[model samples]
Target: MTIREITDLVQGEVLCGEERAGDEVACVFASDLMSDVLTLKDVDNLMLLTGLCNLQSVRTCEMSDINYMLVVRGKEVTEDMLELAEDNDMVIVRTKYSMFKTSGILYAAGLPPVY
Candidate 1:
């Protein structure tokens, strides 16, 4: 689904990369553990759904080449994280919903699991 549609589905706000809201993602990998993200191989067209809202999360995404991130649980995104994300041309989205609900909403919306 498109990032715009994903935002609408999860009631999320685009914290940055609003210009790329038209980008489409075919799959997602949800986790709070950066290590889990580090384990991925093919990162193309994948979006991350995570409760971890720190710089480490964006860093991990940069390392893994995962370009879209949905920060769940209403966790705050720091300026450092946003700066890093912007530097890497990443999309940062935030939602008040829990990880479970956000994952379900995106999955049902046709963004497949990256498992």
Candidate 2:
């Protein structure tokens, strides 16, 4: 699925990288642990879903080469996180749905798993 497709499906707000929403996402990873994301390898076009509202999450995304992040539970991403994401050209989004619900919706919509 593409980032634009996800936005259309979930009605998520694009925090940044609006120009890149049309970018394709081959897989999705749902986790709040930065270490888990960092440990992942050989992945491409990943859309990370998490509720860990912190700068470390952004850093993890950068190091993991994750181009997209969808934050669930309506948690607010800090300015520092956004700035860091912008520097890395990552797309960040916020949603009001819970992590499980959001993941289910995306999965049912045919988003592939990272693992």
Candidate 3:
């Protein structure tokens, strides 16, 4: 699904990367644990739905080559995180929904699980 569709599905705010809203993703990985993200292979075009709104999350996405990150639970998106994400060319979205609900919304919209 496209990032635009994801935002519509989860009622998310495009904190940044609005230009990338047209980008398409085939799978989703919902997690707050950066370590778990590191374990995955072939993460190209994957989108991350996480509640862990920190620099570590940005760093993890950088290292793993994940292209998108949706900060769930209405968590604050710090300037530092946005800066890092911008530097890394990552699309960052913010949502008020809980991780479970956000994942479900996207899943019901046809976003597949990374597993």
Model 1 residue 3 distance off true place after TM-score fit, in angstroms: 0.4
Error of 1 at 43 (Å): 0.8
**Residue 71, model 1: Cα distance from true site in angstroms:** 0.3
Give the Cα-based TM-score of candidate 3 against the true structure.
Answer: 0.97
Clashing pairs in 2: none
Model 2 worst lDDT window (10 residues): 3-12
Question: Which parts of model 2 are misplaced by more than 4 Å?
Answer: none
Off by over 4 Å in 1: none
| Candidate lDDT (C-alpha), each | 0.93, 0.88, 0.92
Please give, for residues 1-115, the per-residue lDDT of candidate 1 as tens digits. 8999999999989999999999998899999999999999988989999999888999999999999999998998999999999999999999999999998888777778877
**Candidate 2: Cα lDDT at 103:** 92
- Writing each residue's lDDT as its tens digit, candidate 3 over 1-115 gives 8999899889898998889999999899999889999999979899999999999999999999998999998998899999999998889999999999998889888889988
Judging by lDDT against the true structure, name the best candidate. 1
lDDT of 2 by residue, 20-101 (tens): 9889989899999888888888668888999998998998888888889999987888889999999999999888888998
Pairs that collide in candidate 1 are: none
lDDT computed for candidate 3: 0.92
